[model samples]
Target chain A: MSDTETLTRLSTADADGESVTLTVNGERHALRLAPWVTLLDLLRERLHLTGTKKGCDHGQCGACTVLVDGVRMNSCLQLAVMRDGCEITTVEGLAEGGRLHPVQEAFIEQDAFQCGYCTPGQICSAVGLIREGHAHTAEEIRELMSGNLCRCGAYTNIVAAIEQAMGEQAMGEQPAARGDGR
Target chain B: MNRFGYSRAGDVAGAVRERAANGAAAFIAGGTNLVDLMKENVARPERLIDVTRLPLRGIEEREGGLRLGALATNAEVAYDERVRARYPLLSSAILAGASPQLRNAATTGGNLLQRTRCYYFYDTATPCNKREPGSGCPAREGVNRIHAILGTSEHCIAVHPSDMCVAMAALDATVRVTGEGGERAIPFAEFHRLPGDTPEIDTNLGRDELVTAVDLPAESFPTHYTYLKLRDRLSYAFALVSVAVAMELDGGTIREARLALGGVAHKPWRDREAEALLRGQAPSPELFARVSDATLRDARGFGGNDFKIGLARQAIRRALSQAAAGTPQSQTDKRVQ
Candidate 1:
């Protein structure tokens, strides 16, 4: 959160390498990282923002799903250098000022996870779904959120959580809501 | 993933220039497949020219139809209002393939350039002709439940894994590209290559050429169309056998028809002779069966995927029937109907 901490986190083996400017979670970060460093690795390893889990380092699983410029994408597949000058919002940035995001609240209420490894990605994906205003039905949500896999088989409840969050966000209890009606 | 130099290009010319500078350099727009391949060591590129910054992200109205930008994300193309309205078959096919995260990151060009998802191809421990030129293909006799059943060679049997391409082949889309030699359009049918002796090459695209856009014609099979993709799972899985059918029906008789198959060949399989049989004919069970039989008459599958031949035949008939009935397969719903 401090300047020294930020610099320490942004420090890479090739610190003077590819210069990139990114705004992650409302913070402007001018970093120099290797081209091979993925955004997932940048967030987790360097920045210590481990809330974005790494289930499968490959893009097959959505555990590393994040919002880049308000669009949901697999962070593992995106190189940090490619995401230059973009606004990235990970699971750590969902809540505002000590309040849990509505999706996070809904996930807890619906008992969306057993192992809790996939909850962050599921929650972030749900937030993105609400943002996209594409999936209006439970079936659509299930289809759209198919990327985020929960190995504990908590899909039924995860969908329920997304459904609840979708309704809540529609009603505009959350500030990030687009007011897309349910 | 292996270390690779990354450079962001501003325009198509610059992207092509960067790629032409180095033969091993690959243009990366929405690195969904390329990054995955890099992780698996399947594609060890020394440098990646990021073309996402290029001004090819627009989905514009071109000549009454549409010009889908090469950089446009799969989600952007599938969810575009015009695409959903005019070309629902393309929308359905795109939605039927990848998940939301993947679709969000995968570009139109990247989708076409994506490598095969064969088991032996992905498993680097095994010998795959597609991966390694002279290593030999284990899928010819090994675990090959997902191998190709049509247009296969003794060297390789890996299928072109793209739901969108199947619909593109049916819709007659044209791939527009640019290189140092200038620009030229590749016909949809001829864009991909069948694995004859060189199993390494997937498409006819030159290493230096950069795809700028894909232009769709004004003609659309609006009323009668269906993209029926039958996969191993309900969602997020690659197709076992998929069919895209677009028809122009005049009351009861078929005026024109375009049919394409996926997960059955090295490219999206389209049989003009089989489609020719439907001209000026009424939609009937026998006619559908005849056409299906004609398409799969020469289809010979490897051991594990022999059942796919029968599945492909039934799937073709069902998709054609669905197009005739004006009931398209829903990507949201997992039901085959």
Candidate 2:
């Protein structure tokens, strides 16, 4: 099919309702939504994955961050139609088989949450930060993880959690199987 | 946000054709800026052409220069070894702008196309000449502390809000674009335009044209370079006044210099006259002060932004000193005072 024709079909397929199939948290969901529905809305409103908080509806805050194709992005800034065939991993996807991911465990041990509102986004952002392999020092962790802001001022504990997670990963305590590929 | 038609373009020609088909159709890449504007009602596109699938995400060394595809994410470009080692200014500037998740999603082309964060422009209820031409500019006499001081038209004073473009302007990059008329190259300085009578138009690119890639010259600034950004906070805030400086020194005398300023104009502010003053001059505080003066001599500030004129001057001096001393600001460094 021509690109325009395909797009036209995808957009007009549901004049009464738009249908989009999203592979979120290793599960596939076919949802009917408006064209203006943001990915954050689809996750929170329709799928009941409220674990991904919405601090700023704009892209300024990283509270709505989720892993698309294993790379972190602001779900609020993205449209549901834009992520048609992509794999999305939210905060709920971090723990597998009831065992917490290393980052999550570290956050709990480090007491990285005061209000616990920004914890999900911060944990997801730290996981993506480790995958990117950019943060080695405490300062680097603070700089790169500046997107997920904690209004409760839990930055020091957050940095410590990220560092602990990094050290565990470096020591080969957590296997590479914990994270899906980007 | 308003309801909009959506489509995905598989190729460059297909994308251009799709954009030409609709007068109000906008090509959405990262959607970091366009989505925000849509939600704010500043942009009311009737159709959106998704260009993320197009094959324009390559970063290659070509013709003794680096060719960065339009869809390459900001994180990819900033973390590329070649960019980090050769063009540290570009890497530092990109890192200094947005947060980690934003950098991961924001494309290089989208960074250039990002709109201003002007308070009046984003508020649909307010009177903004840029958002609605002939509406009259309330920011001219309102709270415009973050407004432009260099390129102020009577119509608008919104400053361009991209640290990456400031470095690109200093690096003498070129923007590659494709449209109905085929491909062409626009110099970095000419790509973004100052807000004159038409503050509505932000760039020189035609409506149907799409940015394909950005080309950087083969030359590299391995030693002397710094991107000094002063902001209200340490992170996740827009620049108050940012300076990108890359200098080539021959025994303490500047052999070549390229300078650009951000958050002070509608576009990345570049002054060849100021750059000319630093050429062949030894790295000294007095020379840096003279260059800063020449650069900001024509700056006329609004009521709240009168302090930026002096702040920008001090920033330029410190940035030059850091570059000359080979101490480019790092992530751990304290915020610029």
Candidate 3:
């Protein structure tokens, strides 16, 4: 596509015509965004970070969830420009080069996906949720993850993956026995 | 999503000044509700004044009670030590709202100022007096399962959608605001207006005024408090019916009571009649039923929301009972801080 065509594709024909520079998954891109151009659109259209999915487009569905400044937010309900200078980590950023993050590995091992469309957002949101320290128990996990929907009914496996990841972190921080001395 | 310009204001004064300078500028905090509306084109502010970095983000002990800053998240207010210990009802109300993640992002001021979750208000295709005056209210005749039953008008019937505000209303909370005219306080009951004539004027706030904090009063009502919410789902959704009640019990007899109804009116409703009737009466299912009747006497329902009136009554009864139980505070409740 030509530069003009690219610009036209990136621009949302809406009321508040604004421009935004977004850094997503460690890449910076500038584009003209409408007041209505959601972070979900910026990720999939402008930056081509297609890992985030659009479910309800409302905050009800967490399918478009991303970590904005290490906190999970529904990207579909967010404006791209509204997140200026904020660090956004999407599902595409979960793996470093070839190694999967432990949460992603656990999700795969626990078979935490069925259709897998909601899996990317689910995993990204889970990572964000755990970092926020909300993965305390099954009930808390269920309550925290209620925003993300898995239509395939893989909630049981998803919870297991999150718990397994939390357990690993707990084991890694055992304090190394204070009495024994370093 | 609609395209719009954005601006970041340095402080509360700067934000309010920007809104005054530009008629279409909206102060954005947390972006929990405003962003959703922007995406749906329900709200099309030309310029957004980001208020997240403003100094309005603390919960302080005031001379009378607690002063919660506008930018204080719902989670912060709910988990604050003073709020939990002195005002358990406020904590319960916040928890009864959307899930933990959403509560973390929703601010106290935003929670009070949030627009109704009426289906008509959300759907741009539908005509709503709240969205567009003279556009008409389809909720009056169409599917109205979640519409208001009390304090409604011919133009609109959508209920105020915050459980926190309901509790605040019962607590006689005051909203501190700063605008072109300077600082002033508004009682929580008077903060939100009824849909009566001008449904568009949700609050008495001037266009330039920014809510800085919510000031609660220090009152020893010797009250048992509870917030009861009825929703389609157990979590992550707005209330269909809710009640926030605080009552003083004297040997199982009601000495005084403060009752507020949610999902029932244009604003969080304080049922004065119910409050009056409950006083000097024994706390019983029968007395609750009578007070509930007094509260819903003039409740005019549309097509599908007549059921909410009864559900709201039941919720009120349950909340009152829980408060009267006088259960000792649990260990987890302390851990919330």
Greater lDDT among 1 and 3 belongs to 1
**DockQ by candidate, in order:** 0.54, 0.48, 0.31
lDDT of 1 by residue, A1-182 (tens): 23354345456545567988889899999887888778988898777899998888888889999999999999999989998999999989999999998889888777889999988888889899899998988899998899989899998888887888888767677443332222
For candidate 2, list the clashing residue pairs, or say none: none
Give one digit per residue, the lDDT tens place, for model 3 in B70-168. Answer: 999997898787888898888878877775556767888889889988889999998889889989988888989988888888888888888889889
RMSD (Å) per prediction:
3.9, 5.1, 5.5
* Interface DockQ of candidate 2: 0.48
Q: Model 2 misses residue A88 by how many Å?
A: 0.9
Model 3: per-residue lDDT, tens digit, A1-182?
A: 23364346466343345656677778876656655556777787767778888777767778888888777777876766667778889988878988888788778778889999899888987887788774598677877788788899999988888877777677883322211110
Interface root mean square deviation for model 1, in Å?
4.0
Regions of model 2 farther than 4 Å from truth:
A1-19, A174-182, B335-337
TM-score: which candidate is best?
A: 1
Q: What is the interface RMSD of each candidate, in Å?
A: 4.0, 5.1, 4.6
DockQ of 1: 0.54
Q: Please give, for residues A27-105, the per-residue lDDT of candidate 2 as tens digits.
A: 9988765667788877876678999988878988788989999998899999888888889999999999999999998
Could you give the TM-score of chain B for each candidate, in order? 0.99, 0.98, 0.93
State the lDDT of candidate 2 residue by residue for B174-283, as single tens digits: 99999999999999999999999999899999989999999999876878999999988888899999999999999978999988999999999999999999998999
